[model samples]
Target chain A: MTTLQAPDTPFLALDVDRVDANIARLRQHLDLLGTPLRLHVKTAKSVDVAARAFGGGTGPITVSTLAEAEYFADAGWTDILYAVGLDPHKLPRAQALVERGVDLTMLLDSITQADALVQHCRTHGVTIPALIEIDCDGHRGGIRPDSADLIPIGRRLADAGCLRGVLDHAGESYFATTADDQRAAAGVERVTVLDAADRLRQADFACPVVSVGSTPTAHATAELTGVTEVRAGNFVFFDLVMAGIGVCRVADLALSVVVTVIGHHGNEGIFTDGGWMATSRDRGTAQQAVDQGYGLVADIDGVLIPDLLMVGASQEHGVLSIRPGSSRRLPHLPIGTRLRILPNHACATAAQHSRYLVHHGGSTDVVSQWPRHNGW
Target chain B: MTTLQAPDTPFLALDVDRVDANIARLRQHLDLLGTPLRLHVKTAKSVDVAARAFGGGTGPITVSTLAEAEYFADAGWTDILYAVGLDPHKLPRAQALVERGVDLTMLLDSITQADALVQHCRTHGVTIPALIEIDCDGHRGGIRPDSADLIPIGRRLADAGCLRGVLDHAGESYFATTADDQRAAAGVERVTVLDAADRLRQADFACPVVSVGSTPTAHATAELTGVTEVRAGNFVFFDLVMAGIGVCRVADLALSVVVTVIGHHGNEGIFTDGGWMATSRDRGTAQQAVDQGYGLVADIDGVLIPDLLMVGASQEHGVLSIRPGSSRRLPHLPIGTRLRILPNHACATAAQHSRYLVHHGGSTDVVSQWPRHNGW
Candidate 1:
């Protein structure tokens, strides 16, 4: 068996057992609600992880980049929703995937994009499936469900025979400090997207799919009544941000950067080879009740070291120190001691790496090596 | 000629003219001091950029990862110094590079590492060149010049016939708020590394290379009398962080992310496909006097868009808005309008991409495609 110490430092390690548990929990929760889970592949970006996510079948998935759509399509997963607002220039690339028999879906909120996609489809003699995004909480891209342009945008795509549905992401749910806030956000997300879908239907536009999700909202939502599918990526590998928001426990975090101790400053902190480049600069937990500096520092066995946090990071070095006033002395770990750092955002941290060392059943032995795809 | 509109949105664009000028400025400065410039390839990681930095030769270079060492070595660049503290387990890989007629140098700052390297070389009967990292500004790694362990560590490597030099990076220089502060930090960095080198020589150890640099210090240092080489990386493509430190002007930054407008949120802001995934979560300019939100937004021609900043970002969307109280009206660019974002840190931002779309002489045309190597 390949041990944890086999690979070099500053590589990503996936706790396969934890990942399976997390996936099972989400699947069970959504399965009870009768909502299909369109797993966001943008987080793991690995065929191995996707295999586990979909139970070894070509399941519906959501992607942030067209590159991801191409990659997963090559891996035999055909149903894809490119979740990012569509760029007109990338229509050709998306159409190519559609021509290959993949049920590729594009997203957009503006009439400009609707018109452009319609033009591109007409010019290319191809009909592409698309989603009109709705702004649930004004977190990011999307037209408001009550906006006058919603029907027009939907009509444009419907006229082109390309309107597939309407989707919304409660991305602001990550900032929720209480469970009530998250649950409320999830409720609004569901109602907002459903309302947009209803408006499309009232306008003679068949809105078949009504999608809504964010990691926090996916778990916090009490009802998925009108939602056809939930698209949550970070839940596959819950991070510190998810834990901070009460969405998941720290123990549920499945991804971490395995690094090596390199040096220490007297009474200040210990340093590691894993910097922002490894752990990522996503300070998603900075505004939470308890700020996780860069990440929560864990021992080689994936156990959190009490009171320790990576407070600072450079390009290739991380400053691991005890939280101020917690202890007077720093951990006197000898150089070369390996540690794992739980990230603030799994998607951002996972994107920093090209592959993952998968550990099964909580063993130190790596059971598999999973390669991840990157770039747009 | 391939126009700027050819590539998909959210790809990095390198202004070759700006890159050449940035490199020339650093080269000219270092040339006057009669110190060789061992360019740090950790920033660009592209052979094309390295070629420009080395003036089309296999010149001495420094890398932050062994993977970079291997990639550049395969490209015919023999001299390399892996700048990060060495991991004992990676000795075999370093030795393999050494065996391949590549003068690959490793770095270490502790006695534990010194002993490990000596043991590894003794066991394999292969000599590996190494540098003793000195703590110049208490920013990151290295032992103090006057520390008792300094000479002992040098003697340990010297006894093994693997000691090559002493090096230090004044990373704290980045925190300097004024020109005088930066100059003073650079002065201290030079003296600290030189003192360690002198001490090693006094102990009968021939410390040949005394390398010192950080982009800020490299530009601010008024003298390099005893320094053998200046190792500066980000100077090849100055970033917002460097500009905030007064090392370079905004116009000198060569790298940018070309994105397309995807949506607008009333008068609050506009959104683009570029986000933390494209610009990187390097909030480097946040601490500066003028906080550049996520990054400074620019027009298609690379000219700074007045009063605008990428105020926020999600995974796949950047919220571009006019800074608060500035005109109160965001630019009315329709969806699909292309824009460029200047990153805060070149090293962190460039690491997000696999290739660069090179625009020579300020032309909108993409003249070349430069591939970059990532992952350790």
Candidate 2:
């Protein structure tokens, strides 16, 4: 009903054609290395996009929350790797997913988690598989590859018949300013997980799968070698952060926040009916060279409004202005003019909305609605 | 079920006792000024909170989205104000609310919106009321008190029988560093709205109601002379941003994010199951004197964990560590240990969750779960 009607402003607009192109680009790159994508469903949690990403079929995917695992499982996605380090308290839900005939794999970097997983499986009468996380660049969670606890943690999982493989995510690679930096980060990620797998294998464990990726690293990495699959979520709808890192061009961003210009603020800028609540407070590009405040602005039809940016935001109000130091004049966008804001981080921005108003090609009208799964 | 079972970490926890106290504090202040509070439900967008906010009865409420307006209206709350600057595309839903017998008042600062409202009502046969926004402190939206267009804007709405009053929000007051500063901001806010309302009245427009507030100004204003009603939202669940501004103490914060220690990140910090995806990427306090990174860290019992802070966040991982330059040792929070993170901004952080795990006075165990209405 919201789709058939004029969409309430500040809704997420997803360009499906751009989604197809992005998927194909990643697929072609990974195909050359004979590595399949275990697409992470964290960004576009909608089963609609998940099906599209796999060429209209469900496939192996990575999830960050059990809610995602359960949602995807209900939608017929059987293989899921919960890539965040396992929290022992979530065992009941994880076991429930396993009981649903899902190949739900959890990730852990500690012996404490391995022991807890072992205990939970034994008590719940369910075998929930797990992957050991390797810290490729210390961007976030993971066990250092050289850590003495690695073997003991893997041994704990192996003894419990829950060890699936080893995985790594190059979180730091997102800050890469060049393809070379991304490739190097990817190389480190690959080597780190493979090394951990080798150590586990030498310790009489069959570490079958080797998973490693991040949106930037995935596109930059040249070879997979012993890796069975790669995982990524934010690549499907490229954003300004990816654009800032030189991973994708602004033209390649498929997702945007559609907002209506409610009023003008003097002659310098205008206010939109969208703000942090709609676009999210993810200033992912602030750390990059060219800080895209909130996001870059575009027309409803997806054409970039040169040098215009959403510079500030409150809860439900966005302030759009010409980029500081730019010679471009502020566009005369009257009240009711719909503007599309390309987000700084696609995953963060996409999470703000519960559904996507699907767009095809360059038309401003939404073709359909796709519900997004949110919350853990 | 989520309440009885050990919770999946990274859920929003709301303290009912704190909520009652916060509500009482604001109500007591407003009562002294003989002004009724038009509670802004934008902060706590749950009907349960809305009910508690009005002492278990529906009263006047302000909403930023039609979703909240519709949701609140369904719960038997009659008086409502859609506070965001009116987007013409949203007239259909607004009309639908009015059709349902909800006294919905929209906001506007431009003649464009006034003319559009007049045309929409004439075409659709629906009478919708509106308030002229006065720009106080140049914070966000609203028309200037002395602007020549103000009289015309009021005239258009007056001719259409849609004029209700004038409103202003001292948004800049949320950053006040002292009580005097907040008081000064509040005085400016009250005077601005009253001046604009007076101008409209002198022009023969019946500007009956005067609404003005922001959490800080509502608490600090010395008088509400000529102000019919005051509006404020964030005081219900005061956050670190409010604390930094000296509006309230940290003990007044009613909301916290409950997360589990998934793993340790060496001796310096621990990783939490919660992150920006759970807490939201609202670094509101970053602009304050003491930036509370993602948020302050607390134990499951709601006790502060001494100088500990959720210093950094990824999509699904939060890094909890002792504050930099502090001598306090980072306490050991082993895997499976639960912790609660007080947020930087309640409105932004609470929006990330779809429900609240209700608790009473220092208790970690949730008493019940209340659903939150989301999206436009």
Candidate 3:
């Protein structure tokens, strides 16, 4: 029963109960899908925060960088898929991990990298597993799902005895307007990974895992037909972006920065210590009908002051203005008024701080301080 | 010189020579204006970096947070202005710093904060200097430059004999498009502080210092007139944003992330490990031009790849796409080809890493590591 003492200033708060609920909700959905959840670690940055999503099991994990892979690996969470394509330079780190008995699978979308990785592995007297990245849609990385590239790369890796399976991240699902759009994106992800898997199988390659993920897609496409594992992140602490994408309710967002009102700019704006550097420059999914500039300003009870939004920000000050067409000067916020702000991107926002000051309402007990990882 | 050597990976590099050059340039300009340069520490989070900027003296610095104020103060660099507006919760931290003989000046913008600070100072038996923040042109914080509000706040503090001077940060000058625009912003900043000083003087209050700054305006406004001290942060490592505002040249940018090529998407694109998380999601000022997506992509030598840009970015993957009209497939970047990425916003970009890998071409060295300060 640890909690942060109420300070009249800005600090990041993690509601452990809300976090558990969010994790349960995501797990329930994945359970219904009968797909293993390979929780993505980029969102939380903290090994402890990420551990909550695992629910006390040695679940497989997805990482965006070697730094994350090393972090989780050091924390005894070894089954990791370095999701970003790898270069030869990472071979040494990968070698160190594998030699230490960690199950590490590198990702790649091109042959040049594959050949180089194979050569590096041969030279090092070690073999590393790899997943051939497939571009389900033009979101970010990957080779075309139906392209001739998949078979060659998949077979080449299999020939090297290091190919794992095919993977695709439906990043576009973050922009989905509705559950159906998310489901559609998820459906496409399944089709893309399964197609690549099928192509590899036809070429006599053993394709075991057809990985598909994106929080919105993972939840929406509960019954991904061919996907063996669902790799999703950001569901643990759903932000305004996730809520805007119809993936979760605002109340489901368990993490927020507790900032204090420091001053009032005339009668128009209230200034706080949370700025772009603290809250991050993420405007959230504001390009849609629901625009959250930076994030939604909320009270301690997690109730959104719909009329108040972080209208502007400097390095260390957030200038919040009342929503247009609304009257009242944002409740006079008053100097020393403590409030929680929901971030747009949980990952980027979380990265701004060194640790999370876990809080339980009305409690003075010191909870746990979760450390975060930084650098490459 | 501490070089963050991770083979050919995209990581931020700080060149001591170029940093010295940039510091020298800012010193020359500040000398021309006949004002002491209170180097802004937000841009370079390193105490060592600030020490280099202060090559002349004990170094009076401006910090964005109390954490930084504490860091530099503990590191023996005493004079600090917590540039951002202050909160009462941090009053204890300030008092502790003052107790340690740190010349700390807390910023106040409203009567409410002024009262609270006064109460805190009284309760703790600590006498701290207070600077009234005046809003020059609403670029960031401060009471309006010409408002009656400025006088009342100043007079109240002066009446209590706690007021030190009036301070203004012309942050809007960062957005200035031309020399005239910078000069105009500088004028606004100068007037904001001078006018507040005038109001205090007219009221028979001895307001000695009038502070105003922003690199663009600091360099452009030669005649400080009544301004006493200037504070500008980003001049330490000129960024792409500074270049876009005509404040410096791209060649003048001294910080960049050296990234490794992981894969290539045919002639369509090339992928690297330096994604938004590495280079930061800041599109810089060029966001108005072509939306450099993440930032301007460069080779290992810091040469901008002609017609090339970071077209897409995820957590750890940056997609380098040649402009649509350009037909050349980049000369085989190949896996492990090291490339340097010029940042969009140096402050945000620099803050992302734990320590800087100081470098000066082939001079591999690890001179110092600076911990980044987060939270209030």
- Candidate 1, A1-376: lDDT as tens digits: 8878888889999999989999999999998889989999999998889888777776999999999999998988899999998888888899899999999999988888899999999999999979999998888888888898998888889889999999999977988868999999999999999999888888888988999998888888889997899998888899998898788899999998999998878778788999989988899888888899999888889888888899999888999988867854576788889999999989999999999998964578998899999988
DockQ measured for candidate 2: 0.87
Two-chain DockQ for each candidate model: 0.80, 0.87, 0.65
Per-residue error for B221 in candidate 2, Å, reads: 0.6
TM-score of each: 0.98, 0.98, 0.95
Q: Report the lDDT tens digits of candidate 2 across residue range B276-339.
A: 9999999989988998999998888789888999999988999998898999898977888888
- Winner on TM-score (1 vs 3): 1
lDDT (0 to 1) per candidate: 0.90, 0.90, 0.79
Candidate 3 TM-score, C-alpha based:
0.95
Per-residue CA lDDT of model 3 for A71-143, tens digit only, reads 8888898899888887777788988999998999998888777887888888888989999999887777788
Error of 2 at B234 (Å): 0.4
Q: Give residue A196's error in model 3 in angstroms.
A: 1.4
Local error of candidate 2 at residue B241 (angstroms): 0.1
The numbered model that scores best in DockQ is 2
